[model samples]
Target: MKHLSYLNKYFLKYKWRILPGVLFVIISNIFGVVPAQVIRNAYDLIVENAAIYRLYEGFDRQAIVYDIFSYSLFFFGALILFLYLLRGLFLFFMRQTIILMSRHIEYDMKNEIYAHYQKLSLGFYRRNNTGDLMNRATEDVNRVRMYVGPAIMYAFNTTVLFLLVIYFMFSVNATLAIYALLPLPVLVLAIYYVNTIINQKSEKIQEQLSRLSSFVQERFSGIRVMKSYVREAHAQTIFAEESNAYKTNSMGLVKVQAFFYPTMLLLVGISTILTIYIGGEQVIDGAITPGNIAEFIVYVNQLTFPVTMLGWVTTLIQRAAASQKRINEFLQLQPDINSGSQEIDLNGNISFKNVSFTYADTGIEAIKEVSFEIKQGQFVAIIGKTGSGKSTLANLLMRMYDPSSGDILIEGQALDKIDLHSYRSQIGFVPQEVFLFSDSIKNNIAFGLDAVTDEQVNQAAKDAAVYQNIIGFEQQFETMLGERGITLSGGQKQRVSIARALIKSPQMLIFDDCLSAVDTKTEEEILSNLGKLMKGRTSVLIAHRISTIKNADKILVLDNGRIIEEGTHEELLNSGKAYAEMYQNQLLEEENV
Candidate 1:
């Protein structure tokens, strides 16, 4: 019922088209009823009255033959033409209405799912597979459209057509009609039971299918790494296992479908046999005319068709129900990060007050009771070893995840109180792993900005030290980057991402080990450019190398999810603590080299 309610809006939108289509269906069915009546009348004329020729005896024999031929041809021809025209027109409108409704419903579902995804905390994505989300957006939405479009219409038509045929049958011979319909209730119940089983199996099959898609997507994305390690055979074996699982589930569904169709056919056949035996007995006993018996048989066959379609409609509904459940689940998910109702200008003054965070799945604190403040336009550096929570801190600042305890503030207002779009628009993030869409280099660099000019894109690329690289490509800025910038080298991809962030001219900038792929010389040059760019921006640099943070106004060294040391470069070196030890080790390694 809830799923049916979901389709009300779509139905209302197409009611005009649907109304005419349905009226045409009724007219077509009326024409269909005419054939049964014609058969009845033909049987009466031929068998019941041998004196049928007496009426034409007074006319010339040739004239009678011609008149009968002309009348029969014109009457049957017109009836057939009317039926065909009504059926064609109804089908035309029905198809157009269903297609339009399908497209609109699919569009709405995709947009809603995407918008909900945007509102969800990063932790949700971290725990979910990319392929699974893609499947929900595409496959699940398509299933919903199928239900709202064809399934609903077919179900309604089948029900209505079946009831109308049953009413006519009963009107002709009440006892025979009741006997023929006795199996209908049992058949319907059987279909419902079969549908329930199919729905359960289909849900499992869809889950397995999603897993298969995820496995394929992951393996393909990591194909280069697998080939580099000579693990092609191993990857293939894993993929085969997932594919086989999908096949196994699909075959299970097929088995159920196979049994269901045969069972429905048997039920319809039995009902037809029963109707014939009983109606034929009545005709021989003079309880009904031969024409009436003929009409009953025709109506019986018509009833069987709708019954047969009942099985298919049930199957479609079950499949759609499974899909709807998955879509509803996604829509119902609530983001952990609350965007509270308050507005404030983001001036880049950030403060962390006793903040702590844990990954949702593991519940292991990644950052513990960390507190810090960066004044507006300050250049702050966070130095940490692998898994020391530096990236997690940056994530908190971006509102990707909220702290498990305590609070973070931007410009003297709670982070939660700020509008997410406004706050995020004011900040730029360059992640350790650069991501580029399959688009022209110029477009990639100017991704989030509105209608940027080529000159502005080139200047931003130059600032990020990537303009030379772009110009060397065959198409320069017009060159399309392959998926995830696969056609570009690691350093070039990183620089392009940097240019994308820089083009935004953000008030706050976060570079999370974004320079790791670039060579030392290029890294130094880009860093020099960044120094100038950071003059009036609050910038946070997460780095492993001491050189990257030496010029920072303040440096915080993190160890094991806690800040172990904090001070200026000279102050940290003079303290002879963790920061000094790290700096001294790097210096000794350089001297040895």
Candidate 2:
């Protein structure tokens, strides 16, 4: 019952529909006893009046026997037909409403989890792998639905059916019914033992499946690397190891299921033997008629099937409970980031006041007590060697992460105090590793906009200097790309990414090394267009090429997580700082080439 509370939240919302379905299940099971009763009545009528004996002493056999027998057969026939027809209708409604309700629950659960994933902070994803989350969303959700559909429906059906059969069996011969059910305690123990083992194994099985899924996902995502390195054999060897683990867990579960069914059948066979042996003596002692013993056997047989089904129903419930627990834990995750409600009039004035941040996993500072200011509509460029905190600073400006030690300000208001969506909706950010959805060129360009036009997409592409390359394609704007735009050349992909950001016409744009893929000629062409894009808006450019940022209104040169150089390119060259050396070295390399 404690475990059921988690699943009930999904069920309670549909109680109105579910309650009626449950009522139908009960009615259907009660009607299931009709044919056996018809058989009992037909048998009793034949044996009691087969001949003119003491049992038929009062009735006139010659005059009334033929008419009475025909009437009896005809009435039972019509009654059995009507019972089954009505029962079938109830069964149909039961399946329709309850089974479909489980599907609705599955739909809601998957959507809720995906929405939660969207809300969760990046750190949460860092800790949990994609395959683990995907398994919970898909497979675990499906198992939970099984509980709401078949487990609940069949458990109710078996309970109602067993009760009705026992009541009728008692009326015919209580002693025989009790005698036949003597092995009931053993059956109960067997079910309990089997379900306990199944529940434990099911959790292990689910974990192994997730592991196998993760291995496949990681391998497929890096298949190009595997092929480049010729490590396909290594991948196969690792896959075989994971698959063997999954198979081992599956076999353990199968062994329990195999033991469970046979154990139930063996107990049922014992019940049948007891009924036949003891029922014969009862008939001889005149405690009950021969027809009464026959009815008792029919009731016991009927009860045995539902009793046997108990094992399967219990197995489903046990598996579902394990799955529900996993789902409940996922639903309970609280995102590390939360949105603030206050909206501010943003004017793109950015400031960082003694900001410092250390990643949670590694307590080494990524950005150390950095301070800077950029007035509205200024083109501020950040240049540093790899892992020198340039991208971290850009990410902070995007509000993807907050400063660990100090506050960031936008237009004199604290960055965290302003509404997250309001602030982010006005900023365009393109990361170092560009990602594009697998869609047509037009749709990919217009991704973040609520509504878009072919004119806007084409203009943005032209501005990013990729328009000629796009039109050269067979489908132009309608060309479909592969996953993550893998079909496009690296420079083409970067330009498309720039186009995606530019179409938004954001108040501020953060380009985190976005031009790394293009040659210097193409970089110069794109930078010329970017000058127009940045004229009246704040821009933050992070690049390795000094030529890219040399024309900026201001450049901040970072070294070892500290802003050691700042001012115009001319000022840094005269000062002979780290920036000047990087510029001189690039010239020397070009001359040597």
Per-model TM values vs. the true structure: 0.94, 0.95
Clashing residue pairs in candidate 2 are: none
Number of clashes in model 1? 0
Q: Which residue pairs show collisions in model 1?
A: none
Off by over 4 Å in 1: 1-5, 12-21, 48-70
Quality of model 2 by C-alpha lDDT? 0.86
Candidate 2, residue 157: CA error in Å? 1.2
Error of 1 at 218 (Å): 0.6
RMSD of each: 2.4, 2.3
Which candidate should be chosen as best, given lDDT against the real structure? 2
Q: Give one digit per residue, the lDDT tens place, for model 1 in 1-593.
A: 46546667767876776676566556556655667766677666556344545556676874666567557656756766776677667656666765576677778778889999988888888899988888888887887787777776677567667777777777878888887887878887888788878888878877987898888888788879999999989988988998898898889888988887878778777877887888889888878787787777787787767777777777777777887787778788998887777766766798899998998899788998999999988889999889999999988988888888989989889898888878888788998878999999999999989799888899899999999999998899999988889999999999999999999988889999898888878888888888888787789999889987898998989998898888899999999989999999999998998
Superposition TM-score, candidate 1 onto the true structure: 0.94
Tens digits of per-residue lDDT for model 2, 1-593: 45657767778899987999889988887787867777777777777766534445666764577677778878878888888898899999999889998888889889998998899887777777888889989998888888888888888788888888888877777888888889999888887778779999988988898899989988887888999999999999999999999999999998899888888888888988998889899989998777776777777788777887888888788888888788777788887667788887666798889999887866768999899999888888999999999998987887777778988988898887888998888888888989888899999899989899889999999989899999999999999999779889999999999999999988888999999998899899888988888788898899998989999989999987889999989999999989899999989988998
Q: What lDDT score goes with residue 261 in model 2?
A: 86
